[model samples]
Target: MRKLDKNLTETLRKTKYFLLDLDGTLYLENKPIGDMKNTLKFLRDKGKKLIYLTNNSSKGAHTYVEKLKNIGFYEEGDLVYSSGVATIEYLNRYYKGKSVCLLGTESYRQEMINGGINVVDGDRADVAVLSYDTELSYEKLCNFVRAIHFGATYIATHPDVNCPAEDVYLPDAGSFIKMIETALGYTPKVVIGKPNNIMGENLKAKFSENDDFSFMMVGDRLYTDIAFGKNCNFPTMLVLSGETTEDMIPSAEKQPDFILESFNDVKNYF
Candidate 1:
């Protein structure tokens, strides 16, 4: 564990719930970050509730649960929330019964359908949703653009431009949005994931009734992860095991309350 200054140490003592980022902060690719298992245990032993929060909309809750369990970061009864869930909730609340055309993976589309969203074909849509489509095709992009041009309302699951995948970065929803914006000259009216308060609302709906309990957001990226915590009014902890580095912090618009090398370093807090 890395040593912490007095202020950060005090801040950690006040925190009760941790909304954790999975891919970078917990594990890089399929490999666990150093000493992560014991670090998680230490937090649990100290009565800190762990909730896995991810902006990756490509996979659903079940898939994430399987992945987390396989990587040994997930315990029984741990809650996992994804951008897809928040997007579904957003659709249900504001656009219930509207025909939605999803530009995402088949699994993400199915998850939308399972959540009682009215996902339909492009031609039949009244709204168009964009997400992290790992299986995106040129045809799908064209269809999505046409749908929006035809007056369909636009919404995005998250605004992340890139997704960290081990040694590489994959273009995420925001990148696709940029292309579409360039082509169609429009952007999504609502983006429901990180840096937006919808996720925080979802979190508060599940937990956070007690004033005595404080919350923290722990993740790797400054824009999505740390920004999310700031938007939610939760203290942010930046970990460098993934998208960000120490050099990236100075010019960042949103700075984290604490910074650590990896999840292994979090052990010093508790």
Candidate 2:
């Protein structure tokens, strides 16, 4: 494990919430990164709250929860939060009772419903939300573009153009956003996930009462995870278990508060 600065130790000890990124941080393609389960157990045993955060909106929290449980990374008090849930909260706050045309999976649509959003299916929607729709259909894609062109408010779940994989990267919501923008000649008015302050604001609103509790964002991505933590004014830790490497640190626009060889290294400090 690389030796982290003394401030990192103080930060880790004081953090009340650990906002963890699943892919490329804790695990990759369904496998945990070197003894990560024990690392998470160490954090939990220290009375820290765990919140698994992801920008992929293709599947709802339940899907991620099940996956985490199967991989032995989840416990009763741990929470799974995706960009879809953040988007749902964003919609209910700003466009309450408005008809939304969501380009997401059926499970994500149900999450919208559960969050009190009036999910619709036509191009006449009052708001148009685009997510990483694993079940995306060409018809739905065209309709979303048309709806945005028809003057519906455009919103995106996140700006991740590609999702990392063991083999090749998969096109995420940002890729679809590019396609939609090509058709409409415009972009989303708001994006509600990592690297955006909306998600941070929502998290702050829900988790912390009066800025007493502190959050620590640990992830593998510079533009998303570390950037989100920086944008949210939270301590950030970049793990090298994913897409980023030691060489990438100097070039990262949003630098992390600390760098760890992997999530497993975190246990060493404890």
Candidate 3:
């Protein structure tokens, strides 16, 4: 572990929970980024709670669990939370029992159905939800555009432009959103993920109300991850393993409290 200043060490002492970003901060695609399992175990041993928070809404908790397990970072008890879960919570709260046209993966659609959303195929949907659809097809794109033109209320799970992979970045939900906006001249009515209050509300509902644990958000993206932490009043840590770089920090609208080369550097702190 690297040496920590007194102030940072004090803050660490008070922090009882870590809200972790998955895709960029911990791993890229199917590959692990660091000795994450041991680092998590180290934090666990210190009586800290860990929750994997992700903005990728294409996959649900089950898929994430399997992926994490494959990368050797997940255990039976660890919680995996995603924008899809938050989006479902938002839908149930505001648009309960409404017909939804989802532009997402098959897994995401199934998860939404399981969460009580009425996923439909036609243009006569009450809501048009967009996600990071890795399995996105041209036919699906046409259908979604048709729904938008037909006046279905638009919603997005998150505003991430790209999702990091091992070697390249895949265009994410935000990129799709920009395309739609350019074609139709409209934006989403609601975005339910990071840097949005819906996810924060969902987190509050998931965690115990009585437990006043000091929290920190650790991630790589300045917009989604760091902005989310700032918006929700949690301390933020920026990792350079993914989307962000040191040169970009000067002009960033949102900034981190601490910066590290990668999550591997974080392992040293413990």
Candidate 4:
């Protein structure tokens, strides 16, 4: 795999669409990389379509848009596809207005509401949806477990264990899933996010079929980002500015098509 540098410009020039990871690949914590806005503008100026693809289901698409705007990467009509949005889409298609018991943040709840799904209280729900909740507590866990034990359909937005932060990684929806599994003796029936068919279908619907399209997946995590690319037959680039560290390379289950220290470093290759 080649390191991202100025020589990769030809490759970038050839790309027609960019599916970007929000947390690690675009920003670290709440801070955007120095050249991030410019890089996005550069891609757009070259006629490439851009979409923000994030596994953090705690927030909705509009929330992501606001966050990006706050960080100065303002773009109109830019699509923000979160795992939460995908989960909503999945439920709408399959369950069709079923009562759901959700274990997620306020934003997630709002997204479910906006998506026309019903969020009910207690174990009587037809389905139990799990997403990243920053305010996760024992009480909420108890309620979710009860719902799961009562045979409610289990669904997870993503299987991300932890989310990258400026100082430390925060437990994601997958971590809570593990806890519930250990206690209930079962895992979620479905996980809709990166590396899943649901996300692929959503993306494919947005971009028309292209036999000659060269796709690339760029992100920081090996499991989610790189695995998604590898599973979907797209080239992957892993940046070291987020979760994957130098020492973890040998043990990585999936390898990236390219590796770079950061997005800026990759610019040199382009």
True lDDT of residue 147, candidate 2: 87
Candidate 3 local distance difference test against the native: 0.83
Candidate 2 lDDT score at position 131: 92
TM-score of candidate 1 on Cα atoms, chains taken together: 0.92
lDDT of 1: 0.86
**Candidate 4 local lDDT, 31-119, one digit each (tens):** 88668888788667767777788898877788888888999875985778888998998898899979999998887898899899999
Best model per lDDT: 2
Instruction: Flag clash pairs in model 3.
Output: 1-268
Q: What are the TM-scores, per candidate, against the unseen true structure? A: 0.92, 0.96, 0.90, 0.88
| Model 1, residue pairs in steric clash | none
- Across residues 1-270, which tens digit of lDDT does each residue of candidate 1 receive? 456668777878888788899878888788888889889888898888889998889988889989888878889757889999999988888898999999999999899999999988865588999999999988988888888888889999999898877667889999998988887688999999998978887777667544423888999989888988888888889999987978999999999988888877776655
Residue 148 of candidate 4: its Cα lDDT? 80
Count clashing pairs, candidate 3: 1
Instruction: Arrange candidates by lDDT, descending.
Output: 2, 1, 3, 4
Give candidate 2's error at residue 122 in angstroms.
1.3
Instruction: Give candidate 3's root-mean-square deviation (CA, Å).
Output: 2.2
Compared with the true structure, what per-residue lDDT tens digits does model 3 show for residues 181-256? 9987879998888987567656766774333237788898888888888888777888898778789998999878
Q: In every candidate, how many clashes are there? A: 0, 0, 1, 9
